[model samples]
Target: MDLYKIDKQNMEKIIGSNFDLERGLQNLIENNLELTLGLEFVASEFTVGKYRLDTVAYDRDLNSFVIIEYKKSSKYSVIDQGFAYLNTLLNHKVDFTLRFNESFPEQKKVEDFEWGQVKIIYIAGSFTSYQMDAINNPALPIELFEARKYKNGYMTLNQIMKTSIPARFSHTHNQHKREVADKGINIDNASELTAPTEEQLLETSSENIRDLYQSMKDSLLEWDSSFEIKPTKLYIGFRLNHRNVVDFLPQKNALKVWMNLSKGELNDPEKLTRDVSHTGHWGNGDYELKIKNDEQLEYILSLLKQSWQQHRIEH
Candidate 1:
């Protein structure tokens, strides 16, 4: 995509600049980890055995550690390096848990974290078609982000989407299965490794709660076609252009929602949303709302729209 500056009906192309890999892009992302990826920074250059991880971040939504590698050059293989890091993390889960505990003293127990949801993220200015193809598996918990910096101090970060390919190959050689040495990844084991699906989460909810969640889901989709519904073990996330706007935690009687807006940015005229900036919550954002009926559904959605628009503007 091309960026341009328009003045008096004349447009000027904005040239992009590149900086030193580690000193430039990597540091920039590390400093802005929370804003860019909704992840908490753990430790940089984290070493386990002989391998050194570029950046270690905590995914609060999934309660897992995410391994991130930044590449200024496109000469490396995503499959080999990504899986290698994942294997290292799987082997040294305790170290990661301890690191998180030390970095943020709020989390108390090792058992509270989700070790199975450990994912790998590779970020670069751009990726080659071959590199993109190397980690395009749907079941694989790997993500690729492309970062672009413009001359006008504007930057863009986009996740390279995976191609829709049918699973015809055997699981023995699949990337998801190959991550584990002998016991290949299967449906039974996948429950422990990956996030739960919308079906799985809604299955435990009562009839009325399920209906209420369905109504909210429909409204969320209708609000923006680009919004995606991502279900984790604890909650269902709604995002637009890779930025999470809201998350839903379904209960037997009510649905708990957390908006991505900041502490006081939410404009809740009805005072329905609670300020959770200081409180420890399962979802993102400082604002939370509990919905149980259809009467306030429209009003709640309006509040959610404010959050969605605020995130859109910030990104």
Candidate 2:
């Protein structure tokens, strides 16, 4: 279980159970590549130039990737290996677009995708002091996680170290963009706003845009009574009238209502996230507020109220 103890028997046993060391590490590196780039999961492995990576994780929100080299048996110097793959990732980022276009052929505005950060991860049962010291002063931005295996062979990867949590989420409207964009920030031109583009056109005639947002926001406030609106440059987060929905344990299977306006269907689509486990679609079109039903809403409010009240007492 504590594979990090670095004993010969424990290390070898884990490698034997997990992989031919080399083969098994390669499989995990390929499969969980998503963890590197902060995406949910890569869903598959891919080659970088001539060199194959253990795993290549990509996060769509960050528009970034990570190179993973897993060591099932013994440790090898990954500096050169990770460096090679990192270069290739930066080089062939456009290939992602090509692959994407194959799926959705009409994606002409593909240049908007921005590449963020790349992390290098070493997943293994053990790491030598020398290896740890080497990674301590990384040449490129990298993170190293050590996987500890149990007697039952239940391996849990523990975060040994991380570069920073700046890239935690995919939403980027500020500094992250400045780093990715080779060019300095360009000021928005007022004249450009006058120009008519398809994106602008779609939002122009939508009557339900305001009406829908107000209705949804009002309903949330009505339910929680204290649901205030707070907008950030990226997306909105809320203090969630937790007093009302404190006990609402939302699960994956819970009917979650997400306000999705079709991409390319409109500019400034009325995008919101609502759990629709019980609520019906409110109104229709852009004004469509999908939450669970009235009963569910009441339950959510009750749970949130209890949570907020508990917090007040704790504070």
Candidate 3:
């Protein structure tokens, strides 16, 4: 993909620019972690054992620590380095807790952190085919983000998404035992780290609610090929470039959606969205809406389009 700059009737291609991996990109991302990625900034160049992390950010939604690495070139293995950093975090939980506490004393208890969903992100100008192939497996909790720097101080983070990989096994003790033995590492169990499937998440919902959720989900996917659905323990998140645009929390009778837009950014003429800026919510965005039926489905979708358009790289 390419970027362009428009001036009145004239248009010009914005050439990609080089940047210092640490000083330029890393610092910029850390400074706007919450604004850009919806993550809380924790520390930079944080050392644990022999490894020094490029950036350590906290995800309050999942209550997990995020490890981010910036790569100027695609020379190293993303899987090896991602897991190595995750392994370090898993082994030395106390050190991470201390670091978080030192940085944010008012935050939640360290024991309550969700270690099961620890995510590692690798950001670079581009990824090789080998690097893309390495993350095709669903067993890994890592994400690849392609970063681009243009002439007019524009930076884009595009997540390279992989096709869906079916889960190896679910709800079988024997399978779990085999996976445990196969890992051979004295680490946490594999079941705990495995992300729940969409079916598993909607199992408790009523038939009507499930149908409604599916309708909205199908519509979102039909909007574009870039739209991807990620089902987490808390909610089903829809994203472009791995940056969440909207999140859905399904109940027995209703589906709640949290759009990833700021307080005043949303253009809600129907007045269906409530201000959730100061209130504690399970999902992102300042706008929250609940749908019990398909009465306002089209209107709701129009609102979602606003969010999707705002987050992507504007032409």
lDDT of each: 0.78, 0.42, 0.79
Flag regions of model 2 displaced more than 4 Å. Answer: 1-19, 26-38, 41-45, 73-75, 99-110, 137-139, 162-315
Q: Candidate 2 lDDT, tens digit per residue, 66-91?
A: 55667765557655555455556556
Q: Model 1, range 13-130, lDDT digits (tens) per residue?
A: 8876545564578788899998888788999999995699999998766678899898888899787777667766776777887888899969657678776667889888888999
For 193-230, candidate 3 gives per-residue lDDT tens digits of 55566777788888988998888878877877667677
lDDT at 50 for candidate 2?
Answer: 76
**CA deviation > 4 Å runs, candidate 3:** 3-23, 148-156, 164-189, 222-228, 239-246, 252-281, 284-315
Q: After TM-score superposition, what is the CA distance of residue 32 in candidate 3 from its true location, in Å?
A: 3.4
RMSD of 3: 4.7
TM-score of each: 0.76, 0.42, 0.73
TM-score of model number 3: 0.73
How far does residue 226 in candidate 3 sit from its true spot (Å)?
Answer: 4.6
Candidate achieving higher lDDT, 1 or 2: 1
Clash numbers, per candidate: 0, 33, 0
